[model samples]
Target: MLIDPHLLAVFTVTTIVALVTPGPDMLFVLGCGVRGGARAGLLATVGVITGDALYIAAAAGGLAVLLTAFPVVFTALRIVGGAYLIYLGVQMIRNRKKGQTDDPAAGGMSGRRAFLNGMVSSMANPQTFTFMVAFLPQFIDPAAGPIWLQFLVLGAILIVLEFVADGTVGVLAGRIGGWLRARQAVRRRIDAATGSVFIALGIRLAAER
Candidate 1:
């Protein structure tokens, strides 16, 4: 086995526990869902997964070691990412005011944009890179197989689990958002709330050491 079965099981359980907790990635998906709808939410999740795949590759290649060694780089990345998120939140609020929801072309959140947003958001999160570097290696066994292959296998398992957990949250949030969108007043409120979530997340990320 590329990974010890017992270790794999333990990793799976630990990952599931982590996923169930409301974290930055999950909250970001939830915001996208509430802002855009189910399809947008799903696209965002895919984007996040794609970004995660790249991070895994980086970790396997030892790029994560370089990143971790440079505390300034990590801090700079977090600040930039947080600022971008704040920008997104502000834009969302502006779009709400402009009634962009009624017109797809008027700065409405499109699927491609959602996907890109998710990808960017995921990549911007330094914590994800750090987590991959710190966590994934715990289960790896150099004696079992090629180290890179082991990383891929473990990464695949994590992505699948993330998709299931985060995807469900996105879809459910989208449904609720869709329903609320039927009422104009409620729709505006939903937009505001969603924007707030992004802003809050941004602040939290920026402030985190």
Candidate 2:
């Protein structure tokens, strides 16, 4: 086995706990679902997964080493990412009124836009890369096989679990949003709530060392 069985089990449980905790990515997906629909939600998940896959690849390629060697670079990236998220949150809040239209086509974000938003949001979070670098290595066992292969295996598992959890949240949110679409007031509240989540996440990310 590329990874120790015991370590793998522990990692799985840890990942589940982490996923279940409401975080930026999950909340972003929820916002997308509420604004768009089920299709947009699922596409957003795909985009986020794709971003994670890229980060895994980068981590396997020694990006962690680069980050460790230049802490300033990481700091700069973190600040920029946090700023971008904040900008997005503010935009959402400002545009809440525009999203009050009864026609989904007119008010809701398109599927392509949702996917891109998810991808951009995921990639913009330097914390994701930092987390991958810090978290994935614990389960690796040099005696088991190649380190890179182990990273890939662990990354694959993480991605699958993320999809399962995030996808469910998106779909469920989309359904509820659909049901409540008739109420303009509800729509406004949903937009405000989602935007607040994004702003809070951004502040949290920016503040965290």
Candidate 3:
């Protein structure tokens, strides 16, 4: 709560950049919005926020150290996360080529499923936990107050930014869905592009040290 202006600025900028980046989180939300609607996207956003909060809390409590201490755990998480990304990417591509708007299967993706998908996608990424552990403390001033308080404040800001960004994307998708729906070819191309991005992210994650 006793935040320095300089540190606040750093956290704000870092959070904005991270929010803007197209990752599994963004892609998942985007896909949800495109396929389901704003409600589905919002549900997924909530799921992502929940997962992010958990990671932030864990990092703040120094839980990341235990996870990182075991190289095998980190490696296994990387593989699982990478494979999940690939699976999501393929699904997006397949949906892109589909013609039905009210497909029972697509409709069957309940809000709970969307939320769980968001949570599991982010939670499975070891990099997210490590990033939080390393990125948060740099802005905390031990002289001020309890480190946990600082973590809570910073984590709240991060979640708020993510919600805003993802919600905006959801709204935009709703507005654009009409036009996108009319053009099958364009939709297919977008699907291919989405798949490529996910695949690239997966490969990068898998190759990471």
User: Model 2, 78-118: lDDT tens per residue?
Assistant: 67766776777788789878846666434666789778778
RMSD of 2: 2.0
TM agreement with the true structure for every prediction = 0.93, 0.89, 0.78
lDDT of 1 by residue, 6-111 (tens): 9999999999998889888899999888778888889999988998999999888888878888878878877887888888888777777676356433333678
Q: Candidate 1: what lDDT?
A: 0.83
Clash number for every model? 0, 0, 0
Which residue pairs overlap in candidate 2's backbone?
A: none
Arrange candidates by lDDT, descending.
1, 2, 3
Runs off by more than 4 Å, candidate 2: none
lDDT of 2: 0.80
**How close is each model in CA RMSD to the real structure?**
1.9, 2.0, 3.3
Model 1 earns a TM-score of 0.93
Candidate 2 TM-score, C-alpha based: 0.89
